[model samples]
Target: MDAREAYSIKVISEIRLERLGLLYGETRIKDNDYVTTVYLKDKPILEGKISLPKFIGDDLYYVKSEGSSALMRQSLYGEPQKVVELGKVLKYEPHGKGLLILGEDPLTKAEKDAPLVTSKRKYRFDGRGLLRTRTSLYLFDNKLRKVIEGDFDVTDFSTNGKRIVVSTSQPDDDVGLNALYELNLDNGEMKRITEKEGSIVALTMNENGEVAMLGHDRGKLPWAIREVILPEEGKRFVCGNTCGSTVLTDIFDGAKERLIFRGDEILTLGQIGGEVNIYRISDGKTEKLTHGQHVVRLFDYDGESLVYSLTRPDKPSLLVRKDEIYDPNPNFKGAIPEKVASSIEGWGIITGDNPTILFIHGGPHTAYGYSFFIEFQFFAQNGFNVIFANPSGSQGYGEDFARRCVGDWGGRDMQELLQFVQDVKKQYNLTKKIGVTGGSYGGFMTNWIVTQTDVFSAAISERSISNLVSMCGTSDIGFWFNAIESGIEDPWTVESMDKLMKMSPIYHVGKVKTPTMLIHGEEDYRCPIEQAEQFYVALRSRGVEAKLVRYQGDGHEHARKGRPENMIHRLSVKLEWFNAHLK
Candidate 1:
């Protein structure tokens, strides 16, 4: 790596991730002298983006990012050009404005004269939030009818908007933990809409009016979204989880009034599979949108084109756009590549012209999405078409699929995944020198893949689990979840820990020949640092070409939230490793 490449996270090294504290990201390709960054400033810390010339200097500073509130400008150090306080507006506002997400020790009498600096809270997710156990909500609108709040959670609407429903929850065990309640926008009466004991996963309302869908916490399979009964006449599909992949497109009415739009192997937000099928409420005629198998997730459907994301083995999420459907396959214009199916069997293909891929997504439950992935795209942008699959253990599918990896961690699931990779490579005719990498469970798989086979030329394992015996105790989640996932209560008992060791990659390190890179955080409690350390130690001891990167102060999500320097360093090392091996 070039020495000129210097970058830092906006937060101080000793600082931990705060709920509302500003986080900054920057990348300077030193050899190219191009500095690209994203940041959010203090107080107004929402999100910011940076663009610098190929050349660098003191004048070469400042990053601009548009947030939910306003666009912000700040120095690389996160010093803002102006100070403007927002009203702290929130939707589905939780914890109330009164809840102290971040705190500071009471200022001493002498310290009162000094500026009062506060500490940031640890949990803050603007999109979908972490669901604890299920709780009830009382939806009561303000006297004005436009504002509504319920048992600690609230939703506010414009004064003109009619009756509204607000969703709220009480803090419980983190899972699909929130219940969606219907509120009378006028009378302020609330009724719980979700009937199942499990939490309602997501909510979607259509512009056509009177039409809505709610996806529930189904078994973690390919996700499946259920339709809700609306009034006496209209039936709508709920938009929570679609059975196939993580990225389920929004639900909508089909060409016929009674037919509901949905598809298996969905690729985009509004668009679905190769044969777009409309399910009829009256008789259930499954009409096809197309005649072939295609991958999909998010897609724009109104006037000009349809856009969406897709999932397949060897890739994660992909973008596809089409002018019209049903006539001919979309031919992406220049700058965008045509989509192709995976080489793996039993997997769908994605539409794109990106390079051949080696995608590594986190979560045995998490799949790829439209959300910004700063680190993943580095390879995609550099000519690697990304690919990955659920392989029966991903979330969004249903509980059955997700739980499949529960007690049976190293069972048929991994074997199916191995088959998936091999099938994808064989079916797609991708290079034999495949690249593999992942984080957490994915990282575990990266380690497992190398030990199981030498098919991949290069591998990257981040925040991985190398030894279950050590991790089950050291992890913060050790107190409760190990029993649930490992099928045992005792941490070190021979039977329980023995099964864990069976799934651990540390025991198989001696069999690895793939040039591997280990990336981990110093503070990751979920997988713990020992997991990475054990694997690295084992690999190095066996004389396998391997490197260990420990990001100071980082936890499980080391890559995204790791210190900026570590981010750049990890990326550089990974890219170099990939370039040397895959390229």
Candidate 2:
């Protein structure tokens, strides 16, 4: 299957409601990727081609970002004219007869020399080296005159031509906090809106400027989908008991105003989970459009129809609609593994045999739900019962549970994972055939688990961090991620360094007896490949079986977006390791 990244989806021409524009990147090697735009109408038939980096459209014209620059076309089918020299436009929208672009400052010669700045402060993480870019909000006239410019990292924003609502985190704001502000385009006056705790992101406003925002309040667990009516009561929740974090992706206001969002539910508790869903909010009701274990990317609703791409455990993604579905990888047919969905505490069983594999998801903040996971399905289809859980520090639960492991990554989260393993073993009458594997923070946990106990027959840690002290200086965002996630004030201080070393997996590697496999991407800066190298060496020096597999020219997300052959090779390596040790 070809690896691809779908960028933007927009309804073109206010008069021609059915014409749609999509920008995406694809490659057979999944390397040397290039971006291209395709126009589609009522059916999913291609109308024309307009290649660009990023794009958006309105009635009379289409605005596109041409590699850190701007271009616009007045007609639906016409050559794009240079609009302005905007640098790396993250997002753009049609405002009145003008345009509002959220982008970074133009690159400078100094920045090009040494882009990344390492320090004890700064918590944000991006694939690109980080000095922390404050994505400014630019209001431009149709003639490309910049009217309004502001210094803030734009989280989300919406405008109705008269007023603009923006959610931003200023330079002085805390590591994870974002504040809401209303920007006046005419006079360029800015007024702070929400001053509450937690990050308020993803802004959506109707034609009348009725704003709805996604608020991840301090004490609230689920992301609060709230309606904001300023000057009196600031915000009120529409729904937050959905047991998952709701992210507002895109919203449109036509005759009927609508908002598009993504979230998940824990179908079968400790076992078969992960369902990333696309939702519609309108007229006092929340409607879930797609079901089953699937991942939806770049979904948009245009009043009468929905257009999106979906990926599942057994199937690659494709452009899909109500009347027709387009499969990009039609030849991607594998052994379809059986899936059983259950409650959070209950089990989602893909029945196979004893000695099942216990998989852990990354992002001590993210989760494992009833979604189609390729790795899990691969293990299950290969005669291994794969059990995973959304332990403490994961979203979907409430704030307390998610924040429980902040200062203690391996403490409660380890217990939750092991306890879930015990539950699965007892329920399924499993023996010593259990193996464990995870990447990133999950990789951190895998490293943590092997040091604490040798319950698993085999272990695989991918793109993991073993030493917090070393990771603080080496990782792309480790300077802050290590301490902030550990609930510390400063990572470089003696007290914090001592605690970090104690929490680091390398400190306890002497006790690890389980055969371990360290798989990493050579180019991973998030959890640099050196982290894996250190762990593999530690295990080998202790006379324990360990092997390191490094993927060249790959980054942190090798399994998800790396070359197709590399992804397959990763699965094969994990499979071979477990098959050798567990069997």
Candidate 3:
């Protein structure tokens, strides 16, 4: 697509979706830039005014405009009715006789100036702009007036008309995991429902307080659907093994209890097995409904059929319908790489070989899957064998496996990754030079690897975290990201800071010998570009070959959804850097 032709469309809501009537919002290129508009099917109904539209029931809809704190209510055809003012909303849903707004409150002068860490050391955070604010939950009545409020970060919630089940996490926990809480809409009371060790991914409750949830327990335990006869007492039994990431879950009564969920159909990285699929669990039997290589998202299940979207490696996303084929760019032929699934000492790898790049996926919570990735195909086309692995910290594995890297970021995780490389080398008997690259957490791994050993001639670290201590004060979510993994309650004390420093690659920069390329997005607050800068400077000062490549006006996700040309450029830079140094 031309720079002047890029566009995006989002479907509004599922209120009356079964009736087959649809409302969509579009953001498209105009005057060589992007502007948002709303549409009714194929007709352009509203333009150059509103964006982020959400349907309210069947007759009304809500939309918010840029730089405005008010959400405008409008009719189906585009007539505006009323403007409802609210704080910046991060997430919300329709709730009992009103709207539920979950966002952050405006920071006060004293609060804004307060140090993030309660230490007397005066850490360097000034001029770094405002820190990420804490989120709170607010209830707006049917009249769109504020009714109830609380200081909690609501991650997930499900309502049953009268009651609501919310998953919330406090900032001080530093673990970044949410626990189940029950919110009584009638009395405006909230109570802790589950006090378990693991995070609650999905939850639903009956009037009796009996609950069913998709739980990801600490370390090695895979996400599972569990039944809690006494949820308020925090007791639960695993009902079914959910091999994949559990995204959504619900329950229904019958002769036997049954749970319906939409999650990954296969647990593997998609290199060898399945996709994000829908399932039904009844009588302790889990049955998968759809099958294919494509990633699937289940929206609503009508008694007759399920409304969904399917996306594959070679095509754009398509809604499940009579004519669902969509290929936005048909000119270029698809690059289909062969799938090679292997396990080295229990760790899994989707393999490619010699002149190969051992790519690590980010998140530690996010997995590399069978879904289409343009970057993978580009590397394969350029004659690079790609071997991406799910090490101990990767999500596709059970929660225990993922939890194994929590307090040991560069320890066992690095060892397992190294073993994966050695095993792949021996299996393929490759003599060619090897390269390595990864973004975010994977980027941190790349930095750690180069410092630990120079087995690889080249390394590319993108959007990385080099110094955990400095990062805690800079990156948007740096505070919790460090605390949770370090198992430290406060990151400012000398002991905790020492631990963080030891874990950071910057502390070991003098050991790095591999020729490195440090790439980052300038505006990335997640792992700020300063991370890349410091690493690059340290490498260069140590007489190691290094280059810093920064993408302008781009954030953490530049490679995936940034400007088209910028994405291509980022990939091209990676290829060029590897091609130049790998040999």
Q: On residues 370-439, what C-alpha lDDT tens digit does candidate 3 reach at each position?
A: 4445565567666777776667666544446657788788898888778777777776676788888898
Best by the lDDT measure:
2
Ranking by lDDT: 2, 3, 1
Clashes of each: 71, 17, 7
List model 1 lDDT by residue over 265-297, tens digit each: 111222222112212222322222322233343
Instruction: Quote model 2's TM-score.
Output: 0.75
Task: Please say which candidate is ahead in TM-score: 1 or 2.
Answer: 2
What are the RMSDs of all candidates, in order?
Answer: 12.2, 6.8, 7.2
Q: What lDDT score belongs to each candidate, Candidate 1 first?
A: 0.45, 0.60, 0.58
Which runs in model 1 stand beyond 4 Å of their true positions? 1-164, 169-171, 174-176, 182-193, 204-213, 217-360, 366-390, 394-406, 420-434, 468-495, 510-513, 521-530, 541-544, 551-569, 580-583
> Residue 195, candidate 2: how far off, in angstroms?
1.8
